[model samples]
Target chain A: MERILYGDNQFFAVNHLSDSKSQALAVRFKDNEAIIRTLDHAREAGINTFMCTTHDRIAQICDIIRANPEKYKDFKIYPCMPYAHKYANAMTDLGIAGTIKQYVPGNLFGTMFKGGKAFISKDYVSIMELLIDAEMKMFKGIKTPVIFLQNVMTDLLLGLGMVDLLKGYHDYIITKYNAEPGYITMNMPKLLDTLEAAGISNPIICASINKVNFRMSGGKEIYEETLRTRKFRAIAMQVLAGGAIPPKEAIEYVSGLPNVESILFGASSKANIQNTVSTINNFDSNKV
Target chain B: MAVRVALIGAGKMGISHLSILGANSNVEVVGVCDTSKLVLGALQKYTQFPCYTNHSKMLDQAKPDAVVIAVPTKFHYDFVKDALSRNIHVFAEKPFCLHPEQSAELTALAESKNLVNQVGYHNKFVGTFQEVKRLVKEGHIGEVQHFEGEAYGPVVIKKKADTWRSDPSEGGGCLMDYASHVIDLINDILSPVKEAHGTILKTIYSSQVDDAVYSLLKLESGASGLLSVNWSDETYRKMSTSMTILGSKGKIISDANELKVFFKDQKCPQGYSKGWNVKYVTDLAGQVDFYLRGEEYSSQMDYFINTVTGESPNTINNFKSAWITDKAIATIKKSAKNQY
Candidate 1:
């Protein structure tokens, strides 16, 4: 993982702090070239990794990167899946069986046969793998060093006490995709414990870890204790607490924490990107 | 004593509720009922809670103190009626019922039985919207002049095979699935819509139902607003519901994520300034024991569970309030038909 990972939230209109800003960003990045230009800016600022959701639009981003392999040689994408809206819209347009048939990632007969058997046997693991493949279809040639399970699904499975699926996802991403599996969750303490119990030792986990405890489930103290005590690789995200905290204070707080290997953030402008990169670098150098 | 709860319909929302309920120490999930054998099989395999194919049978066998219903809108009436008749507290998903009459009947039945009843209008639990309600009530934006409520999403982007969402009888369409949320928010934030005019239920993709709904709603307070909702908008990643209120003094724009208020003078509320004030959901949202998707989902469930356990009063999101939203829907539908 890169020390600084660029997030795709701003590009996708997912501003947790303000919707108007999100709308502005949505307009700003409406064209693919604009997204490419901003990404180039991030790359210039010494950030190579893009942690993004597997939205349909990201497929176009992947196409652009694929076309310019020389320019994006060091650029990496960490895809988070499955994008809930894609499945939701697909489920609405097509029935459950039809959605599975459409996205199961194989010949119709093979997909149907496997989908039929999975449905009959209630083999959720197979279904999960199939969906992962389908989500990964867009990032075929890109360098996805890490694949993440979005919090919506990750926390759901955790809340459901389905540790086996978490374990299944971990094993499948490693064995099939040959990438380190990362879990993005709201509850870091609970997910860390669950992942450890599922035999995934020292797993890579991304979560909201900031001064304000914005979306940090199980409270901030517990998260701090977990980061200090646990062996997992922590990717501190939402460190600014959705703009509640000053960037310097947020970075300082997260950088002072234990075992946070990476910091993930999203910004639209080159100045903001450059400012954040310098802030993180300054804090890291001061810490060292 | 934990509130023994039984869940009916283990679909998307149902499963979410089940997870939240299962995590709540104040609630004990005794049974789960769904029609799909596959869903039931998976639940049976994964969770220890008893699973059933029939709701009535589950109610009889599990004998829960409360029941959470997340079936389609068409089944809401029958399922809620069944639960209420059995003298069980009910938490049904919105748009409360298929018709206002059905909702009224259920409301009366639940009230007569003194059973705690709640409709899952989860937006009310959203912090920004909750803040919007508080600001509006405090006259922060002054007397409201006009408002615009909108909800856009990519639910139906293309011509496709009919699902329960596209079927009008199943409480499909922008009116029920999408607009009901905005309408409910408008009704709660302002007042119940007493009349609607210039209604246009346009179909962009779905054949049987309207993919978009537009109308002029007259609130009971005599304040009128524009209602615009479209489900076929591919630009939105998900359903984005917002309200822009133009008041005599200033204006307020709010969505699920943030609230922006503009005041004419320095007579602003505490923590807010004159020119423009912004607040994020993180600052306003209440904490929940278990969270999924958004805090609102867990907050709403916690509210219902607390209400059911007599720990909290049944004030917000009760059946009576949801009935008003149903009535608003009925008014919008009638206005669309009487198009002049």
Candidate 2:
């Protein structure tokens, strides 16, 4: 299946989104007409299926898969869950808890998941407990996919052991339930060490690019080093801040670098998609 | 459908406007004028539009429907007044004038002309900021109480000791270049500050310009705001333009990219409760439905052109709003002298 290749996880995230702000499968299904347009554009640009959320829109995505069985059959969906109720319901009914409920302590969006896939957040209050319950339920048929996404501010928070439970919990999930997790990392050099010490391997690490605070050189160097260390399987990219980098230049800039597997780009319109596609397609690796 | 647009001043900001306007569909760069032949000559290659050293000549030949004034702050009043008197819509860059009184006159002139006018406050168009505004309006953070904004970056100085940014006489300083953004954001998100006390750090980087400024603003809605602007950072060339709004129910923190809202209901650890909460939202449809169709230049130009055509609402980036920013700058300068 060529591993159903993608440039980055955000490709999946964006595929799940209607554009950038529509709710996932649990809230509204088949409502994100724009997201379908974007995914179609991505497919035209030579990408296959990626992991994303359907939220309350899960059934709509199912319909999409049913409608175009070959096109979207390989899509990897990861729905987000913030609390116990969402997790519990996902295990059984596969729908998230309604929005008005008092989400479980440490559960961020327990109110949003109507249920389907267990999208476990590392920032949740009782991440360990939530992961344990979610994993147990997923073994019975639910899908629990965890993501570690944070920047410097959250990194400072996680460094204080706020995410330690996640570290231990990830190990337990991958080893016991065959869970495959992913992390969107900032300061790739630093986080690579953390992943190594914990013996965590299944989770893919994405190094976000920040032109000001975290330069591309540092990120690029760390990615190359990690590739050599055999600590990471793939590297996804993100922008820690917003700046106008022409899509063509940005893709050309990263595509030539060593150990870069994918990039998470945010596009506001279809023109951006065309420009970005043209840029990605224009990469000449031999020139590097 | 092309709205003829004229470029005035032909400076760095003017060049940026020209480049972006060139890519817009509804806008056509009809003419560019500047005093310096050097500036005009350099810009000619970037535009197929006519170039003239005189604004009046360019305006006469180009007969532009709109004009973008990107000259120094001192020339803003005269240039804007000239553009508006010609019945042309005006788009001027910030710190509209060197003084509040001057900006007040320009504002009045704009009103009399009744043509579309917008300031180059492009930060408001950013996706995350729009998200913040949406979240705040939706009461995602509850009742607003206090807000704080800060824009910090390393000081820009001249390698040759004669950079225009170092000249205080020409609207060159930390407050003029940067503090306006802080004040604009504060005023836009909250109401204009009713009163403020501020302090500008002088000679932190060099004796040429003040290194930083801090302001304590009192908003018209009784909300308090703390604004800080620093041009000098001992570390790297990183900017952290952040804002936090503390409301009655919860708080929303704008961490540059993400608008994190900490709700009252989410249970937190025994120690770290009621600070900041992260909810992973995966939605692309709503945002992309609007974003995926337009060119960057057209998005902004369309907004400006529609404002001029009266087909869309005229954006409120007038001189009246700029006075609030000028007042904040004055407070910082005054506090710098007192240093209490």
Candidate 3:
């Protein structure tokens, strides 16, 4: 887990605070060129890891990164899965079978054979592997140290008593990809409990941890409690709390936590990027 | 007592099975399950049998002797496993298990449990195709040297976001949906495929499913087969499948409803002085209890029920046969996609 990990939400127009801002950003970064330019700027700012959602457009970004490996040799990608919109749209076009079919990795029938074998043996973990491999197709031969489950699906599966899938993810990331498994959730406390019960310890968790509750389920107290006491890595996100808290206070409250391993934020401009980085470092200096 | 049956999908083919099963008096339609609420609502109007959204609950409560699974290709693994593990016979619609590996496992389980397993390769039961099989097996077409199978339709020309068939993932497109019929026919009349090689072209719906699938097959019997299928052909008046089998002494040509046999030497079977003998499938269909699409649907179900009751020796479209077809499909798609 890096101390400062750049994010792709801003590049993909995913602002939680305002719909208009999100739409505006979508228009602003509609071109892949703009995305590449911003990503280069982030790289120049000394942030070497881009934790990104596996949106369709991200495939192009991955292509650019792979093409210029010399430029991105030190950079890493933390892929997030089941880009909700892609799945939703795919389900509409292909139905459940077709959508699953599309994600079957290369060697069409070979994947089908595995898909079939996985189905018959009730080896759902193998199917999960297929999906993970499917999502990671574009990032082939690139550096992916960690893979995160998108919060929407992670929390939904959390609610469904499908903790085995989360555990499967953890086991697979370690066994298959040799990468760390990460989870994003609005309800980190509950997820941690579930993961712990699934026998996963000291896992990397990304969540909305801020001074204000913002989108944090069960509020900030339990999040703070987990941060202080839990044996896990924390990547604090939404620290600005839907733009309610100022940057300095947001950074201070998040950094003041006992075990914040990383901060994930996305910005369209170089100034905002520099300012956020400075604020976190300044808060660390003040604490010292 | 009626044979207890449960159905686990409400898609188009599922609904077809529902219709045939509903009309059959030899079986009890115990339950129906589907993922979509609207499809469930539609099934509700057709059966007094209970409906469920989850397969596990339906199986637990219904405790059916047999399961009819018509869900998408991806979901076949779970439902089939659940049924087989519980020692239930299964009648799954084609492309069976989406892969040969899955079929091999499921087939082993069914055989281990002494449970009946059948895939819906309905063309095997069509009157004309049945005739072709008879002639081929009886040596009316002596050791088929060359074979060409074609199926054309207008179902997938435009962007159809309304149906799952337009998408490749859900087992969509011409190869899985249409050409599979041809693959099965090649297996039925000739021999199981020893080799399958070819590619698919996505002309109209490039981003979705392949619109066309073309394959070359070498049957274990040394007969060669060609497949040219296009689901996006708007010129097709209706969905149609046609085939031509060339043999040493004669030839056989057939479409959905008719078969024509050509004997060059006039050394044909008992009732014919055949240069060319034509038979319309309508003249061949025997009396059947319930028939729609083809008598094949009801006929095949009847065969499965008999196998379940130990009345028939075996079904021709068993999971083993489908395993071979899935293998061919996989080999062809691999060759095709790799080309791209």
Candidate achieving the largest lDDT: 1
Worst 10 residues of 3 chain B by lDDT: B38-47
**Each candidate's clash count:** 0, 43, 7
Screening candidate 1 with a backbone cut-off below 3 angstroms (N, C-alpha, C), the clashing residue pairs are: none
DockQ of every candidate structure: 0.50, 0.02, 0.02
By summed lDDT, the worst window of 10 consecutive residues in model 2 chain A runs over A91-100
lDDT of 1 by residue, A160-264 (tens): 777777888899999998999999988788888778887889999999899987888768888889988879999999999888999999999999998999999
lDDT of each: 0.87, 0.55, 0.77
Model 2 chain B weakest lDDT span, ten residues long = B283-292
| Model 1 DockQ vs. reference | 0.50
lDDT of predicted model 1: 0.87
Q: Share of real contacts kept by model 1?
A: 0.42
lDDT tens digits, residue span B174-276, model 3 = 7887788898888777888777675645556645667788778778898888889877675443456888999988988888666778988878887556588
The model with the greatest TM-score is: 1
Model 2 segments beyond 4 Å from truth?
Answer: A1-288, B137-139, B155-160, B234-238, B266-299
Instruction: Give the alpha carbon lDDT tens digit for every residue of B70-173 in model 2.
Output: 87777788888888888888888877778777777777888887877777765565444556666667666666899988777644432223345566776766
Model 1 regions more than 4 Å off:
A92-98, A107-123, B338-340
Q: What is model 3's DockQ versus the real complex?
A: 0.02
